[model samples]
Target: MEIDIKKHLTFPVFLICFLLIISLIFIFPALKMIVLGAILAYLIKPIAFKIQSKLKYSSVSIIIAMITVIIPLIVLVGYISYELYSVVSTIITSGSILDINQFISQCINYLHINVNPNELSQSVTSSFETIISYVMNYSVSIVSKFANLSLDLFILVCSVFYFVRDGDKCLKFIKSFIPDDSINFFDKTIEDIKNVLRSIFYGHFLTAIIIGIFGCIGYSILGYPFGAFLGVLTGILQLIPIFGPWPIYWTLFFIDVISGNYPRAVVVLLFGFFLSGVDMYIRPALSSHYADIHPLILLVGFLAGPLVYGIVGFIAGPLILGITYTVLDSYRKEYLMGDE
Candidate 1:
């Protein structure tokens, strides 16, 4: 009477998997954008729902929410890009670099180092020129591929809209595939994944924002040029596992030291130390309520993600890894430990 259930299901499951593989192959090029959109949608869903409570129209709420959130992000990115270009171009063209070179020479002499200052200056100039040139070329390539970029952006927007609106439906549909026995595991895994996301967002990203703000205020008070930009860079560097605001403040400190500004140097160094030290408290305080993710997971994700998924991979990599970890842990708890 059982009628060989496993035998009958095998062909159907195979057929479904085959179709999925084919579909994935076709959408491989736009996969990153699609993933990015889904991630954004997940983050934006609450905002959209808040708006929907007022508007009573899901689509309109989502649109307005997207605009409000996405516009500021776009503007911030554009401003950073423009400022970076301006700084690089100015450095490449201006005589200010010579002053920096002179500073380097003075530092070397003060240290009683026998290295050739002219050779070192030439090397620094050459390295900067090469890096700037490469970045400029890369920027040009991105502009040249406007059509492709537009297509990706279009796909991203569409994906976010649909995912935000239908995400619950999608989750239900997925749940339908889970066996009754494993449903608890699936639910637990999803909860863990959500916790992971919250942990990363609050622990890492929020900390970065706070540190960046402090950097901006401190550097400006110290009379540094491009203080805001340095702060932004500090924030970004804070996202990486091993690196923090030390690089920015240390460099500034050394620059001040070479320029004979000891007071500013000491102040900036102390400020930088504060920025670094505060992260220890802030990250744990924010994330401890959620999942505890290992630093290695994030480090690998951040480092290797861009290679596979481009810039969007930065977000996707850690997320995917964190989710994977949660799923594995859930499986162990539900199956392995349960059996034990």
Candidate 2:
């Protein structure tokens, strides 16, 4: 007896399948991390391949490349942490609070305004003390989280190794699963992803390094306190769109203002402004040239990524959008428009 397929499959079966997929997603979140690592490995494959060709050992080359990349990052973090601690210590010991209060009072007096400076000073000091206490308490939890993150880092490193070793075979296997008609489309999409990664690595990451180096050198030359910390802050902020460097620059400016070091502050501000403007030109030009994508698309992606996925969203957002556009264009040209 012949049976109808639709009669046997019902709404409940669909619901069960949906729930099962969702559960699997939660259980296998590591898949996302692996995918991220694979993308990173692909971007750095050229360097790994070169090293392997010279050394004749893929595993050793991969490990050496990973260490070469990771060591600088570790050193940067350690330096920044130490510099920030030094700044905090200096702020606690120096009479910065009193100087700031006096400067505020002088400004108010010059404006012909009458106010109780002593009361204002006391209130500000109390608030600052409370904030310091809260931050001290919070540091404990932050340290605990850092310790746990070590495990995640280990997983990420392992994933990077496997991705580098098997990346070519993996891509080939995945391509085999795609339909013959859509192979070209898939190839174009992969190329788009590579372009995006290249843009990110060259444009964003390299620009950040340049800015950080400039900041550190400039601040140190000008005898700015916590120069290293400010530089690192500036670099990290560069990762954020638009307002990233403003906070660090402004904080240093205000500190100078309160300390009666207006000349130094003005110089720092001018230097920062120049460096930041240069970054604007460098990032867009590099991104456009490498990715062959519109700068406007990148600008929009930078803004939209954080709104959609928080910090990591910036990278993910641009990548996903770029791939989508490439795939859709390929589909239109091949099947619908029949041009390519």
Candidate 3:
């Protein structure tokens, strides 16, 4: 009886089975966090590397860089939280329902629309009471969320440190198994990934910082309450493409109008328009220079991110698009252009 090993197992079949088992093993417990950490590490690796070059140790450099990034973020969040609490307390204590109602009535009058102030004031007061109640109820939930977020952030920071330190070793170990002929292709793919991450970071972050700074300055100049907080809020809103900062400015404008601060409001409104326009131009230019991806692709990714990944999705969205573009470009260059 001639026993044929080929009948029991083929090389390609065995390899596929092994890969499937390995993939399942690795992708189950911490896949999402791993993916998030990897993306974050990729974006920050350049900074880590720069620090490492100076300090001569990846681990130490990463720790320092992580602290540098984390501390400022913590301070920012703390400041914002404090400001939010102050605003909430002021709103609750002042009982400014009447002022708001009077402002609304004046607006209606200016627009030549007749309305009943007594009825409107009563309705407004009711609504304000409901809002306060809702806020009180929501406070616990928000606190719980922050607790969970803090835990997640701890994990994320630890993961990023390890990733920055061992990422290259991990890549090389994995790539070693690939056929020698395909090594160049794998290397190019990794390069594309790095480029995409850098592009996404450069594009979104720098623009957000600029907008936030300008917004804070503008609000302070106009003597808006909680100007810094609102400015930061404006920056966060700027992540949304096309119409991010408009609502913040518009609300402030309306508030000023009701307070009989028309000149200040008008000036703010104009400044807002200028800032918004500058963002429209600056964001795309910065993104294009870094990623070289299509504007429409970035725009779509910006819209799609929050829908897909919640808040983190916004960053992930453009990143995915950038990676896709880079990979396709690489493939075209290698397969199609070379053939031509």
Pick by lDDT: which candidate is best? 1
TM-score of 1: 0.94
> In candidate 2, which residue pairs get closer than 3 Å at backbone N, Cα or C atoms, i.e. clash?
none
lDDT of 3 by residue, 238-307 (tens): 8776657898899888878877888998998998898888887887777767567776787788888779
Whole-model lDDT per candidate: 0.88, 0.77, 0.80
List, residue by residue over 27-50, the lDDT tens digit for candidate 2.
464554555677668766777888
Clashing pairs in 3: none
Error of 3 at 212 (Å): 0.4
lDDT score at residue 278, model 2, on the 0-100 scale = 74
- The Cα error of candidate 1 at residue 321, in Å, is 1.4
- Order the candidates by lDDT, highest first: 1, 3, 2
Best by TM-score: 1
Q: Each prediction's TM-score against the native?
A: 0.94, 0.79, 0.83
Residue 328 of model 3 has an lDDT of: 89
Give candidates' CA RMSD values in order: 2.1, 4.7, 4.1
